[model samples]
Target: MFPIWIHTKEEVKRLLILGAGGFGHMIQETARLLGYEEVVFLDDAVKGADVIGKCCDYKAFLNEYDTAVAALGDSGMRLYWTEKLMEAGYQVPAIIHPSAVVSPSAVIGNGSFIMQSAIVNTNTVVEHGVLVNSGAVVDHDSRVGCGAHIGLGSVVKANCVIPSRKKVEEGEVIFSTRRKIDGVTSRNLEDALYAFGFGLQCSYVKPFGEGHINETYAVYMPTEEGDEFAYILQRVNNNVFKDPAGVMENIFGVTEYLRNVIREEGGDPDRETLSCIKTKNGCTYFEDNEGQPWRCYNYISNSVCYQLVEDPEQFYQSGNSFGHFLKQLGNYPASSLKETIPDFHNTVKRFENLEKALKRDIKNRAITCRPEIAFALDRKQDCKVLVEQQENGTLPLRVTHNDTKLNNILFDAETGKGLCIIDLDTIMPGLAANDFGDSIRFGAATAEEDERDLDKMHFDISLYELYVKGYLEATKDVLTPEEVESLPWGARLMTFECGIRFLTDYLEGDTYFKTAYPEHNLVRARTQFRLVDEMEQQFAKMQEIVREYA
Candidate 1:
C-alpha cells in the first residue's frame, strides 16, 4: 500500500491549491464548501483567483503551512507535485465531497479527490493523486491507479484496471476490464490523416475496435450524392509488426485476389473481403510524420463483428469462412507473400525463444510463475513434431491467416452468415493445420482466455466437433492428404505454442501483448497450457474426428 495521510479539518490550518487552471478553481470551490476559510493557489502564470505564490515559491510556502493538496488535472505533473509535497513533510490528505457516496470498504490514496455525486464502490482502491470526478462511478474491486482520472459521468465497470497517468474521458464507457492501450485525441485525427496523404474532408472520427494490436478509428466521409461512407483508419503497432510494408503487401494481395474470386462467384466483392484504400501515391500503406505506418480500409457497413462466440452456429460459420478462404487462395502462390512474422507457427522456435527468455529472466517475473514455467519445460519435445514434419516435405505450406480466431470473421447481421474476413495483417505462408488449430484453440474453449478459475476452463470437445465439421465440409476437396492428416497435431501444437509465447512475454516484461495487470500474461499462459493438457488426453479422439469429417 502507498503511504498516505488522513487528517481532520482542525488539523489543517490552510490549504494550498497547486494549479491555477479551470480544475484549480473547482478545487478552490470544493475547499470553500468544506468550510476551509483559507485557500490559495500556487501557479507560475495565469494568476487570477487567489493566486498567492508560484511553484518556485512552494518551498517558502511549505515552511509556513504544513497542509496542502494538489489541484492539478494533468496526471504526470500531479505525480511530480505529490512526491515533492510528500518529501517536504506536508500532509496531503484525500479530499472527498460530503455528497459523494464512498464505500467504507473503499480505499483512497493521499491527495486524491472524490467529487460530488461520485461513487467509489466496495473494495475499489483509488490511488495517490487520483480524481473521481462528479457522477463518475469506480465499480467494485477496480483499481484506479495513481494519478489517473475518472472523468465526469464516465462509467468504469467492475474489476477494470486503469493504469497510472491514464484518463477516462467524460461520458466514455469502457466495457473491457483489460487495460487500454494508447488512445488518439480529436486534435490528432486530422494530422494523422494528412500524414497518410488523405486530403478528403472527414465528417467524423472516433475510436473503432477493441483490438489490442492497433489504434483503430472509424472515419466517415460524405459522398457527393449525399450518401455517407465509412472507412477503417488504423495506426499499426510497429513493435509487433516489424515489417509494415510486407504486412500491407500481404493484405493487398490477398484482398485483391479475394475481391476477384468473390466477383467470379457472383458474390458482392466489397462485402466479402476487406478492400484496401491505397494511399494517394498508390502505395499499399502510408508513413506518418512520426514514421509510424497507417492504413485504411472500406468499412463493411451494416455488418456485425463479434469478439466472442455467443452461438455455436456462428462459430461453425466462421470455420467455413476461414476454410473457404484457404480454398480460394489455394492456387494464389503462397510463396509470393512475404512472411510478416517469421516462424509464426514454428513451435520449436517458439520454445527456443521461451528458453532464452527464461535464461535471461530480465524482469525477475519468472520466480513467481514456477509452475507455469515447469509446465512449459516438461512439454518441450511436444513442440518439435510439427516442425520436423514440415521440414521433411510432409506438410505443405499454404497461405494461412495465422490468426483464425472467430472474431476475425464478420457475420452478416441479418443472415447470420460469415460475410467477410478482416484483420489481414498476419496473413502468411504456413500449414493449413495452423489455421484449423488456432480456431479450436480459442473457439472451442469452455471459458474465456483469462478466466481465473482453472475448474471452469476446459476443452469443449463438442465445439471442436462443430468447427471440424464445418471446416472439412468446405475444404475436403481442396486440402491435400498430408494437410488432412496434420489437423489434429495442429490443434495441439498451436495451443502449446500460444502458451509458451505468453510465458515468454511474461518473462520478458510483457513487451508484446497488452496486459491489464502484472499477472495477466501469466493467467493467459495458464489457460492455454490447461487446454494443451486436455488436448493431449483427447489426442486420439481429435484425430479420429478429423478422419471422420474427412
Candidate 2:
C-alpha cells in the first residue's frame, strides 16, 4: 500500500510549476489528474499564455498558489529552485504520477517526481529533488541520493546506491557496485583509473557535460581530508575525430607551450591551462581493452561555465579570453600544427558536402526541407568569400580555437573573469576571422540554437559590439590589417556554414549531429539561417562596429 495522495477537488486548489518546458507540461497534466483545480507556470526563457511570470516572480503569486514544483531537467538547476520555493514558504510536495507504482515501504523525499510507469520497489529511498523518469525502476533496498536523475528505462539493481547529483544514462544498468553503458563498462573505467595512477580508490564516476562529440566523466577519489572530484576522464569520439593520436599530440604540444607562457607572465599554470595526466608508462593516453582511447586531466577548482549569455560582461570576458589566447600563440609556428580535421573551417567544402547529401537523399528528407535547401543554395557565393581570400594570400593563417562557444571558457568564481580556455580538440591552423566569427554566431544570439519558434530568434547587435570591443582590445597589435578587415565576413560566413552543415545532416538522415526528435536538425538549421538573415540586414552596422573596436 502507498500513501494516499489523491486529494478532493476542494482540497487542492492551485499548483505552480517553476519551469515551463516539456517536463512542466507533463507535470501539469499529472497535477490535473491528481485533482488540482488550476495550474500555472513560471519560466525564465519561455513565454506563453499559461506562463504567469518569470521564475523570480514566484513571491507575487504566494497568496493565489499555495503549492509548487520545480520541473527543471538539469539536476543542479532543479535543486536550486526547489530550495528557493521551500524557503518562500510554499508546499513543495513529492509529485508521483497516478500510474506510478510505489511501495508503502519506500521513502520518497519532498520535491521528487516519480513519472508515469516508474516503479519504486520495497525499501527504496529516493531523496529530495530527484527525478525517476518514465519507465525507470528502483529495485529493493536501493538508495538514490539528492538531485540524482534516473533516466528513462534505466534500471538500478537491488542494493545499489546512486550518488548525489549523478545521472544514469537511458537504458543503462546499475548493478550492486558497477555500472554499464553503451561502449564503456565498469571494468574499462577501473582500468583507466589504474593506468592514470589515481592513488586513492575512486569514490564514484558520473557523466559530466553537455558535449555532443565525446563521453566525459567526473572521477571522484577519496582522500584523508574528504572526497574530491580530482580528475576528468574522457573517451574521444573516433567517428568525429578520426586521428585520436594526432589530436592528443596537438593538445600536448599546445598545453606545454601555454604553461611556459603563463609561468613567464606570473600566472598559475594549473588554473590558467589544462594539465594532461599521463599513464603509468608515460603515455599521453591509455587504450582500454576494447581499444578505446581514454585520457584524464587534473580538475581545475573554483571556476564556472555558463551555457547561455546571461550577462553582457561575461560575453565580453569570453571575447577577451579567446582574443588573449590568439595573441599568446601569435609567434608559435601555426604551420607546424596538423589539420586535426582536414579543412575544418573550409566554408566552400561544407557547401559541397551539403550538395552530396542532397544527391543521395537516402532518407528522402530533402524534399521536406526545400526552403532550407534554397537557403543554402542562395548563399553559394557567400561561402566562397573567405576561402577565396585564404587562397589568394590575402588572409593569413593563425592558431584558431575552432570551438569558441561561451561554455568552453571557464570564468573565475571569485573574480568573475575568464580563467581558462578548454575543448582543444578542434584547435588547428585556421583563419583568425573564423575564430572571432564563431564566438559571435553563438554568443550574440537572442535565443537558443534549437528554439522552434522562429519569431524568438534574432541577432542582438549590442552583444556583438561588446564581443568585438573586448576581442580587438586584446589582439589589435598582433592581428594584420587584412585579418582585422575580414572579421565581419567571418561572423556572417561562419553562421552560414553552420546552417549548411545542419541542413546536410538533416538530409543525410541525421547522421552527424545528435538529434532528440525527427525535426531537431531542421529546427536548428532554421535558427541558424534566421540569424544569418538578420546579420545580412545589419551588415553595414556590423562592419562599422568592428572598425570602431579595431
Q: Judging by TM-score against the true structure, name the best candidate.
A: 2
State each model's CA lDDT, in order: 0.85, 0.88
Error of 2 at 444 (Å): 0.2
TM-score of each: 0.65, 0.66
Off by over 4 Å in 2: 1-185
Mark the regions of model 1 whose C-alpha exceeds 4 Å error after superposition: 1-188, 195-200, 222-229
**Tens digits of per-residue lDDT for model 2, 1-550:** 1222221224477899999999999999998888878999999999999999999999998888989989999999888887788888887788888889988888887688999999999988898888999999999878998889999999998768899889999989998644333323478777777677652257777788888678898888778999788889998877788788888888998999999999998999999999998897999998888888888898899999998899999999999999999998887888878787998899999999999999999998988999999988998999889999999999998889998988899999999999999999988999999999999989999888899999999999999999999999999998988998999999999998889988998988887777889999999999999999999999999999988888
lDDT of 1: 0.85
TM-score of 1: 0.65
